[model samples]
Target: MTEANLTYVNGEPTLRFERRLRHPPAKVWRAVTDPAELKHWFPAAVETELRPGAPMRFVFPEEAVVDGAWDGEVLEVDEPKVFMFRWHQDVLRIEVIPDGDGCTLVFSQTIGGGRAGFLAAGRTAAGWDSCLDQLAARLDGTTVPARTDWVTPMAHYIEKFGLGDGTVTATTDGYELRFARDLVWRKPADTWPVLTRSLETGHVTKEEPPRVLEYEWSQGGTVRWEFVSDPKLGERVELTHTLPATLAELRPLALATWHHRLELFFAAATGGVDESWSEDRVAELVKHYA
Candidate 1:
């Protein structure tokens, strides 16, 4: 599978992916257009005639279902070369370039505007990443289970898009942290002062004893801490950070700073000192992220 490339086109977020397969253009084209072959890898089972201006309906399985079928119209159909369609408010395009006995497939989707668009960019890219992986497996004649884990790949996409560097368990208006641990016997109210004092800045925004505490970071983000009961981890603390898009050059530094601060928070809460927490360690982290 190829890495998804994200860019802004006409102020709208667009995601593009390319894959080089050993199969010829016609074999790849049929796999994308034919419903029987598509069901093996595509998110939905497609129904339509192979032609331009044809109406298409995408049906999801009962076990892995969505709200309803995705209805779309084929915009262009140049056999074994290009297939373009209108999917919801987004345009999906596929181009096949012959490469000797093999072919390269380019897929692009234009994501529209609003709060949802920004949030969906990472998710959509990750979904396509998995689908393309599955497509590759199918072409290679290997049987693999459907992918149910999106957290790992979504984190990669989030970082690739220069949003932030953290393990994202979930993403809505902002990204959710993947770190969750039982903080020994500490409660949210008791934790708040330690967090504030250690950071030396940031004011508390919302505080609910033992449950939720939120604060605004002086640097440029909001941090929320929540305590919840987990079946496996028992009582655990979850932290979430929301940050605006920053300049590309500053992303690595910003990510390292946040990671370092989180380390400090953990040390303060546990009364444990990490010897690795030093300038050299931070420089190593910056290099790793870079």
Candidate 2:
């Protein structure tokens, strides 16, 4: 596999990449173009007609399935050889060339924006890298590793919010994060209060989502919430928070606090206790949340 070449066309964004795989045309073609086959790697629902002028959609997870999707039209189709489609309102081409047993897959995307768009174009390029790796692993029938590179983003968030030294308790509602430091509470919409902040000395730094925030006080680093799932539980509701760290470090105090948050959210939301988060039942919840 080779890195994608990214460029801008008249201030537009574009990305391109190439990969060689050890499979025949049919195998390689299905791997890249099939929705069921893609799920084994990317873990998302894919919808497309595999024909010209048809719409394609890739949705992220919410309820063990896709919640939102990107809708685009297919412009060209040369089946098992080459195909082009419209993504982000731009053109994307994918080509497969047969080798001895496998084939070479070449992918490219073109966007009509500027520098900002070109920078953003790199995101899809990286995403392709991840997705292709998963595809390879799937072809080999191997388990894909969970991506857990959250340390940098966590540290960045801590510094930006000016968050003070405070103990974090794992709560079920989310994370019962209370800043015990002495600081003045500024007006509403303060990034510090909403994200992370220090109540003492008014030292606060805010880190945006999908961005890293770090804390050096503990070598173990700070807790981070990744994905959130809102599930229906009869009259109540269960908010599942996927923290970056594992269950071992969050045990004892932290675990209890997290449970409390879940309880609070459910009780307040529907005026009742949600038994799904009970210790005996948490294993199941963790499985889904993980």
What lDDT does the true structure give each of the candidates? 0.67, 0.49
TM-score for each predicted model, relative to the true structure: 0.59, 0.49
275, model 2: CA deviation in Å? 41
Where does candidate 1 stray beyond 4 Å? 62-66, 165-290
Candidate 2 global lDDT: 0.49
Q: TM-score of the candidate numbered 2?
A: 0.49
TM-score: which candidate is best? 1
TM-score between candidate 1 and the true structure: 0.59
